[model samples]
Target chain A: MTPQPTAASSPRPVLYSFYRSSCAWRVRLALNLKNIPFDTRPINLLAEQNKTPEYKAIQPFGAVPAFLEANSQGPALVESVAILEYLDETRPELPLLPKDPASRAKVRALVEAIAMDIQPIGSMRILKYIGKDKEAEWTSHFLKEGFSALEKMLEKTAGKYSFGDSVTMADLLLVPQFYNGIRFNIDMSAYPIMSRINSELETIPAFQASHPTKQPDCPPELR
Target chain B: MTPQPTAASSPRPVLYSFYRSSCAWRVRLALNLKNIPFDTRPINLLAEQNKTPEYKAIQPFGAVPAFLEANSQGPALVESVAILEYLDETRPELPLLPKDPASRAKVRALVEAIAMDIQPIGSMRILKYIGKDKEAEWTSHFLKEGFSALEKMLEKTAGKYSFGDSVTMADLLLVPQFYNGIRFNIDMSAYPIMSRINSELETIPAFQASHPTKQPDCPPELR
Candidate 1:
C-alpha cells in the first residue's frame, strides 16, 4: 500500500502508533477504510521512546495512536477512539457510524464492549499485575465472558457485517480485538459468528492493510 | 421524571442496575435527562444478584446497567458508553453527541478517557488485583493522572459543559468518573476546571437526580 499525503498541498495526517496496539490498529483501519491519506510515525513503545520529552509534549498519556491533525485548530489528539471518530467525521466518504441512531448505538456498544471490557482485562500491564503464568487464565476468562455477550449481540444486530453489513465503526473495533484474543490464545471457536465476521473483515483492504503484522514497525518475530 | 415507554411498549425498558456502580449511574443520568420513563430493578452486586441464573442469562458478564430493550430487535445491550449512545440515538430530541464529527469524537474521547483509562485502573476488581494496601495508592494515582488529562481536555472543550456550553454526553460520563475520584478521597484542587464543570453539572436535574446517593439500594455508609 502506498502512503498518501493527508493534505492536498501539505503533509498528511501523522499517526504516532505502535504496530501491535489494538487501539492504534483501530485508527489505522478507519484511515484505510476512508481512503484518507496519512503518514505513519511508528513510536517505539517497547523501547520507552513514548516517555521522552518531545513525545510527551504531544501526548501526556504516553499512549500509542496519538494523532496529529496538522491543520486542526485543537492540539493533537491522544486517544485512539477519539482519533477514529475524528477521521470518520472529517472524511465521510465511507462512514464508520450507521445512518440511523439505534444502529449507531448498537455499533458503539459493540465497539465499547471490546475496548472497555475485554481489552483492559487482557492489557499488558494487568498481566504484569497477576504475573505471566496467571495471565492465560485471566485472559481466557474475560474473553469467554466478553465473547459470549458479543456473540449474542451479533446475532441480534448482525447481517453482513457487525450491524446489517454496512461495515460501520464496530467492524474496525472488532477486528483488532479479535487479534488481541488470538494473541492471548483465547479460543475463537466458541464465537463462530464473531470469527465469521472477522474472516470477512480480514479480506477487506482496510483491515488487510491495518493488520499488525503488515505494519512498518511490526517485530521481525511476529512478522 | 416520569418514565417513557420503550420502543416495543409492551413493557417499560427494564434497567438491571446496581446502586453504586458508576456505569449504572451513567444510564440513570441519560434516562432522566431524556425524560424517558423506565422501571429500575436493582441487582445487588454485594449479594451477587447479577450472578443469579436469570440475571446471567441477560448479562453474560454479570455487570450492572444492562438495558433490556423493551422492543428493539437487538438483545439487552451492556456497557455504559454503549447504553448512553443508544439512548441518545433512539431518543434524539436532546442530542448526546455534537452536530459535527470532530466535536462528537472529542466527546467520545473524553468519555473513553474516563471509562477506559481512569475507570479500569480504579475498578473494584483492579483494587483487588493490587491488594488492599496498595489499592488506595493505585486508585489515587490513576484518578489524578486521568483528571490531569481531563482538566486539559475540559479546558479546551468547556464552555458551560465538558465539550462546550451544551450538556453533552461527555458531561454525563464526566459526572460518575468524578464521583469515583471523590470516593477515593483524591484531592480535586489540581483539577479546578473539572471541579468547576462537576459543580455546574450538579445543578442540572439530569446529573443531580442520578447521583448514586439518592438511589434506594445505596448503602448508608457509601451514600
Candidate 2:
C-alpha cells in the first residue's frame, strides 16, 4: 500500500540526506513516488560534519540518506536500495518488484548495473579524489561503458518503464543516473533506450519532484 | 531451490568475469555455494577486451560478471546483485533474502553499503586511473570508512551470518571485501564484528570455493 500523505499536523518521516547525493535522492524519489512526506536533515559532507560523533551514531558511514523509520523497528538506516526496499515492503500498494522471480531479478540487475558499476565510478567523492581535470574523463569513460551495457539490457526488457509500463525500483535508479550524466555533460542521446526511458520518467511526479534542483536542501541559488 | 549439482557432462554456465573484481566474485561465490558448475570466459580489463564489439554485444557496458543464461526469457544480464538475485529466484531452496521485509532490507543495505560505497571507491579500474601510490591511500581511506560502518551494522544484526545465522546474499558480499582488505594489507582486526564474520565466512565451502585463487582465470603462480 502507498504511504499515507503528509498533512499539516502529522509527523513526517525524517530523511537524513544531502542534496547532491544520488543515493539520498533515490530515497527521496521513492518516498515522493509513493507519496510519503518527510522532513530533510541535510548532512554537510563538505564540512565533514558527518564525521562527528553525534552524526556517526546516526550514520556510521558518515554518508547521507540515513533514514529514520517513522515509528517502527529501529533507528535510522544507511544505504539507498535498502531504504527503498524497506519502503516498498512497508507500503506494498505501489510495488517496486515484480511478483515473479525472473522479472524481479531482471529489474534488480538493471538497477545494480548503474548503481554498482556506473554511479560509483563517477560519484563526487571519487571525482574529488581523482582531481578536477581527470574527473570529466573518468566519468565519461564509466558513463560510456555503463550506458552501453544498460542500453542492451533495456532493449531486451523495455516497456513503459525499465521492465514494463509499471515503474519499479529500476526506474527509481535510472533517473538519478540520468541526472548524474547531465552533470558530467555526457550526451544522453548516445543511448537511445536510456534516453527514452528517462524521457518517460521525467513525466512522473515522483521523479520530477525528486530532481536534485527541487530538493529542500538544494542551494536556493542553484535551485 | 538450490541449484542442482553439476555433472561432468553438464553444460556449465558461462561467466564473463575478471580476477580482483568484487562484483564478479560475488556471483562466483554464489555459484560455488550452490554447487552449480560454471565456466569462465575471462574479460581482460587491462587490455580492455570487454570494450570490444563482440564482448560488448554480450555485455553492453563490457563489465565482467555477465551471466550467459541459456533458457531464460530475458537475455543474458549484467550486475552482480541481479545475477545473485536471479540465481536465488531460479533456485529457491537456498533463499538469499530473509522472509521478512525489514530483515531483507537490512541485509540488502549491508550489501549495498559495501558494493556502492566501499568497493567502488577502490575499484581497480579507478585505481589505475589515479595511479598506484595514491590509489592505495584512497582505497584504504574509503575501505576503512565503509568497513567501520559495516562493523557497527553487523554488530546490530549479527548471528552466524551477516544477518543472523543463514548465509544470505550479504555473506556473499562480505567475502570479497575481505579479499580486498587482504589485497591492501588492511588490518581486519580493526573491526571486531567484521573479523568475526570473516572468520565465519571462510569456513563455508561456497565462499572458500569462489575465492580469487580458485578461479580458473587466476594466474597459476597466484593460485
Candidate 3:
C-alpha cells in the first residue's frame, strides 16, 4: 500500500534536487534534521537534467535544490541557503539557527565560507568550463585555501559540531563540502578541527541519510 | 573630543571593511538600514592590508567586512550575510527579512544569486588569478549569465524593491552587484525589472551613504 503523507497540515514539500550536488545535500540534511517531510524529485547533473527548460521553470538558474511547498506557493524556491532558511523560519521546531543572534551569525559565517567561497569555485560546471587539464589543480588549491581559513575559524568555535554540540546550518554546510574535498583528494591533515567535527557529524542519522551515496540518483557503482 | 560609544547597552560594532568590496558593501547597507551605530575600520584591499597578520586576526579568511560586536566576543565575524542576519536578529528594529517564511526565502535566494553565484566569480582576486587577458570576457560572461537568471527572478517577485515595496536583503545585495555589472559594462537593457528596482534603491539615503565612492578609504580618482 502507498504510504500516507508525513505531515498532516499540508502535502509534503517537493524538493527538486540532485543526489550528489553539495547544495542539494545541504537541503536534504536540513529536511531530515527538522523532521519535515518532503518528496525528492532528483535532477541528474551528469545527465544535464538540471539544464532543461522544465527544470528552469522550477529554478530560474537551473540549479539543484528547488523547493515547492504544498497548498500555496507561486513557484519552486531556488538557492540552498534560502531553502534552509525557509525551513527554519516556517518549521521553527528543530531550529537550524541558534536562539542568540550573535551565535546564529557565527553559524551563518561558517556556512557562507563553504557555500559561497569554496563550493562555487569547485562546482562541476565551473571545473568543466575551466577545462579538464587544470580541474584537479584548481579544485585542490581553492579547497585547501578555504579549508585553511575554516580550520582556524573552527579552532575558536567548534565543539561537537561546527557551532557547538548540536547541529546548526554550519554543520549541514560543512559535511557536503568536506565530502567534495575528499573527492578531490584534498589532504585533511591541515584541518584537525574540521576533520574531528566531520567525523562526529557522520554518526548522526540525519547526516548519514543525507550522504550522496545513500541518495536514489547516486550511481550504483559509487554507492 | 572622541565620541562616547553610541549604544549604551553594548559597544558600537566596529566594521572592518573595504570601500569597493561588494561583500563589505552588503554589510554597510545592513548596518545603515538598521540604524545600528558603527565605526568603520577600513582595510585597503589594493594595498594588501587584508593580507596582514593584524587583519587576519580580525578575519581569519583575511577578507573584508569582518564585524566585531561590542563587549564579549570570541572573534570578529567574517562574511557579509552573517553580519546582515546578526544585525536583523539582534537589532530586530527594521527587519531585513520579511515576516513570512516564503517571502524571506525569496529575498535570501536573490541575495545568494549575487553574493554566491556571481560575486565570487567576479571578485578581483579570482579575476586576477584567472589571468588578465580574459578577465573582462570571463567577468562579462558570468555577470550576464547571472543577470539573465536574476532578471527572470525579479520579473516574478519584484515590486518597488526585490520583494515588494519595502527594502529587504535582496536590495542590499542587488545594489553592489549591479554596480559591478556597470563597471564591467554588462548591458542592463535585458534586465528591465532589475534595472528598475536598482534605480529605485539608489534613491534611498542609506544606500546612497553606503555607496563605494562615499567611503573614507576610497581613492580620490576612483571617487
Candidate 4:
C-alpha cells in the first residue's frame, strides 16, 4: 500500500533515520528547528537495514528519514524535503518558510539546489553506483560543481543565513550538505557564502543537536 | 545580485526555457495548468546558449527555466519546482497544491521522487558526465530503479492523477519525467499506475500544449 498523505499532527512524529544520511539530516534539522519533539527509529544504512521488508513498509523507496505522524501506525512519508515542507505547513510556529511568496520561492530554490543537484550525487545508492575507488572522485567533482553554483546563488540570497537570517528551510538542507563536504574533504573554504552560513548554523543548538554524529544510530567512534 | 524572491507578480511572467529540458518542461506545464499566460525566452541547451553571460545575468547557475515577473527586469527564480510553487502561491485560481497538509506532503513526495531521485539522472549534465558510450546504461539503471520504487508509492496515492483526482503539481513533474523515460526507452508499461496517469494526462490540453516538441525552440524534425 502507498503511504497515506498524513501531514504532521497529534502525538509525536516518528522519523525513520540514518545518522550520516544527509537527506535524513535535513529532516532532523527541520524537526529540531520547529522545536517539535520527535522519536527516531534508527535505520542503519551502513548495515543495509533500510532494505528490509519491515522498513520498506514505512518507506517503499527504502530510504532513510521516512516520517510518520497522527497514527504512527502506518503510512509514513518518504523524501526529506517533503517531510520538511509538511512540518512547516502543519506546525506553523517556527515557520520554516518565509511569509512573502518571493522569499519563499528563493528559499525553495536554495533548498532544491542542494536537495536535487548536490545531495543526490553523494547519496548511498549513487555513491555505490559510482563504485569503490572512484566514489570520492565522482562525489568531489559533482559536489564542487554544485557548490560553486550554489555559492553564486547564496551570494544573492544570503543574509546571515540562506535566504535571510530567519533560518528558513534552505538552511536546513545547506548545513547537512556542508557537513557532507567536510566528510568528503572538499575545500569548504572555497565557497565563502555557504561556509559563512554553515558556520552560523553550527552555532544553533538545533543544528548541532540534529547533526549526524548526534543521532541515535551514530557509532560512538564517529560521535 | 540574488534574484529577488518576489513571488509571481504583475506583468506576464517570462520563462527562460529550452524546448527539451525536462526541468523547463515542468514549469511550462505549471503555467499551462494554471491557465496563466506567459512569454518564453528560449535558451537552447543544445546550442550551449545557456552558457552565455547574458543568460548568466538572470540565472547565475546558468540553467533554463529561470522565471521573471512583476517588472520583467531582474531577480528571476531558478529551479523548476520553485517556479512551480511560486505560481501556485500567486495564482490561486488553479490551486496547484492540495488543500490538507498530508495531501500536500504526498504530492511533494511524488515530486521529489522524480525531482531529486529520478530527474537528475537523466539531466544533461549527468548524462554528459557519464560520457557517450555509457550514458544510456547509467540513465536506464537509475530510471528503472526509481520507477520501480515510485510505482510502489503511486499504488497508494493515485486516483485519477497522482494524489487523487486533482491534477496537482505531482502530475506536472511526472508527465515530463515520463517523457524522458520514453526517450531513454525505459519500459512504461512496467509501472501500470504511472502509465495510466500519463495516458490520462496526455488527454489534457495543458499537458499537450506544454510538450517539449511543441515549444518554440523545438526543431521541426523533433516536432
- Compute each candidate's TM-score over C-alphas: 0.86, 0.86, 0.93, 0.95
Candidate 2: stretches off by over 4 Å:
A1-11, B1-12, B37-49, B70-74
DockQ of 4: 0.73
Q: A1-223 in candidate 2: lDDT tens per residue?
A: 1122232232567888888888888899889888887888888787777778777766667778887776533456678888887898888878888898767878888888878878877776667767897777888887887787788778777897789889999988898888888888999898888898889989987787888888877889998
Ranking of candidates on lDDT, top first: 4, 3, 2, 1
Candidate 1, CAPRI quality class derived from DockQ: acceptable
Predicted structure with the largest lDDT when compared to the true one: 4
Write one digit per residue (lDDT tens) for candidate 2, span B1-223.
Answer: 1122232232567777987688899998888877777778788887898878777666666677778654433255677888888888777777888998778888998889888878877776667767876777877887887788888778778898788988989998898888788788788889877788889899877777788888877889998
The residue-by-residue lDDT of candidate 3 on B1-223, one tens digit each, is 1122232223778888899999999999998988878888889988899898777766777888888787645367779998888888788888998988878888899999888888898887688779989998898888888898888778778888898899998899999998999999888877888889889999999999999999988889988
In candidate 2 chain A, what residue range of length 10 has the lowest lDDT sum?
A1-10
Tens digits of lDDT, candidate 1, B91-121? 8999988887767877887888888877876
Chain A TM-score for each of the predictions: 0.90, 0.90, 0.92, 0.93
Question: Candidate 4, B142: how far from true, in Å?
Answer: 0.6
lDDT of each: 0.78, 0.79, 0.84, 0.86
By the lDDT metric, which is better: model 1 or model 3? 3
CA RMSD of each candidate after superposition: 5.4, 5.7, 5.3, 2.8
- Superposed Cα deviation of residue A107, candidate 3 (Å): 0.6
Residue B108 lDDT (model 2): 90
